[model samples]
Target chain A: MYGKKVKLRIFFFSIIFLAILLTTFLILKSLEENVVYFISPSDVKVLPELSKKKIRIGGMVKKDSIETNAKEILFIITDYKSEIKVSFSGSIPNLFAEEKGVVAEGFLKDRNYFTAKKILAKHDENYMPPEVKKALESKK
Target chain B: MFNIFSPSKIFSITSRATKYVFAIFILIISVGLIEALFLSPKDYIQSDSVRIMYVHVPAAWISLGIFSLIALLSISILIFKNKTFSLIAKSLAPSGFIFSIIALVTGSIWGKPTWGTWWAWDARITSMLILGLFYLMYIVAWRVISPNNANKVTSIIAIIGVVNIPVIKFSVDWWSTLHQPSSINILSKSTIHHSMLVPLIIMTAAFALFSLLIFLMKYNTELIKIKNKGLDRL
Candidate 1:
């Protein structure tokens, strides 16, 4: 058996540890509804009645699927299997491009349509742009 | 293990090694700086701003690493009654706190340019902030309590605070985050290009060496103070 001080210390910290664990569990449980996850278009298709809570839909930008008006930009996010139309009024991220990965956050108006509040473009790890790649190829 | 590193031997090695660590730290840091500032390619998307990751990620890694070390040292103190474990933990806390602060500040700076906002309640950010807060609380516990009482109390705090480490590590996977997923992976080929990855690795090495230098200097000072006070031989 350990000394009295070591025993007391362990007991003290065990109480603290349990308290922290309980607090974390309760917080995560309470915020469960808000823990949105990136879902592909096919996942959206399988979802039940849509709620007002915000969610993120992630996939590639379908080629030539972008349409821009004076105010709003409309695009389709595709997972190569299915697609969801996203409409946004705000400016998009710098990395946003056709045929690139993107995740849009907003409420779904329907199974086929998403009214986006934000657009985040995913950048690949490749540092060389196509043009730079071409230039380097020619140099080689 | 405790007797293996006698106080006199620990003092001799640390004093001798400090100069060498300082030299190596300076050399590696210089190379890291050059690579980060000039040699590394900018992100195709984030442009030059991506350079911040070189410092930010490494600082975060160090903060987590040091906290883990402190947790291990605390266990050694509590279970094995290793006399030198508490001193080692004391030596590590200040640097861990500094790294935590650096990680937070640099993360905020990176977030502003990349995320288009200064701060958010994203799970990763929130967890990192909590980790930094724990580091602050650990340092404060050591300072406020009497020396006789502080060792056990701080050890308990360090041991318990380890819960936050896993939270910090898995926060990205557990919740939706504005922060991107990790580019560097241990199990597979990392997503980052070698052009950028080289600098990041160099910076991380530099930071690790710098922490070693700092820990050695701090440990020597703490040991000297203890010796002067006629507390223990070490």
Candidate 2:
């Protein structure tokens, strides 16, 4: 059993704790735009002006839209509603493939074309063996 | 209720229990390693590199879980003014810090193979880095401050640090991070298959036991210090 002093202390601490939590929440909420790591192609579509500054465009690698050469690789990133053509000279990640998620960091040349300085693959949370994945694919 | 948590009683009980905990930890970890390394199904995409998830996920979970526990204990310390609670919180910190480091390092390694980079300034990863820094600050507070001041200072540090826990948990959901969203959900069906989930659960249990072992050892040392100082109560 707690004494009166302890109960008062508990109440006081809870108030302080809640205050701190609220302050943190507000700070993070205000900085929401800065915290977003990348923007999707759908987001890029409505951009009023194209800038030279580097930006990251993230979306799925469009199915059957990748073309490769010894000097560079070209791929179309699509968020279903919109698509951006990305040209990258750098090495692509192993996970980069058709219909898989990818993020390209570079400059947007126009509304439709992006020149990428780097490519990073993004994989989904799903995990399964090759055989099971094959079975799922077949069923689909 | 407080009588059962007296330093001498806890020290003796923990000292006796340590061996059994260690044995269980070793047994569980051995099986966990085998299951995680060999038995678990490889990812359809990432393949064997997905095995890193066994270590990375468990370490992150334990670090997050321990920080939350310490924060709760910190609140108890403030409310009850109990030395035992402070001791438990203090003893719990080192493992939390260690596991946070392990999580960060393992995540980096896992990231390189899968995400194609060792590091990213993404929201989820950045928030996790902040959590690790908070753990560092909490440990430093204990070492730098005097005993009487340490309890209050460390408790405040923990209480403040705990606000980041939810930030880390929800960062992926809230932001357009390079990291994928969570697969394991409590309220709904998990995306991860059963074969992988079983090993993950086993590894998490093993990691929990290992942290418990570390806590008991540290707690016992603190109790011995109290005894050596000739203080009968904590």
How do all models score by TM-score? 0.82, 0.97
| Each prediction's whole-model lDDT (CA) | 0.82, 0.92
Error of 1 at B151 (Å): 2.2
TM-score, cand. 2: 0.97
> Residue by residue across A1-140, what tens digits does model 1's lDDT show?
67788788678656866897888778777986565447789989998878788888888899999999998999999999999999999978766889987878899999999999987765444453245556767999
For model 2, state the Cα shift of residue B36 in Å: 1.1
- DockQ of model 1, rounded to 2 decimals: 0.27
> Which ten residues in a row are the worst by lDDT in model 2 chain B?
B1-10
C-alpha positional error of residue A128 in candidate 1 after TM-score superposition, expressed in Å: 5.9
Q: Which stretches of candidate 1 lie over 4 Å from their true place?
A: A1-43, A124-140, B173-176
Model 1: reference contacts kept, as a fraction: 0.20
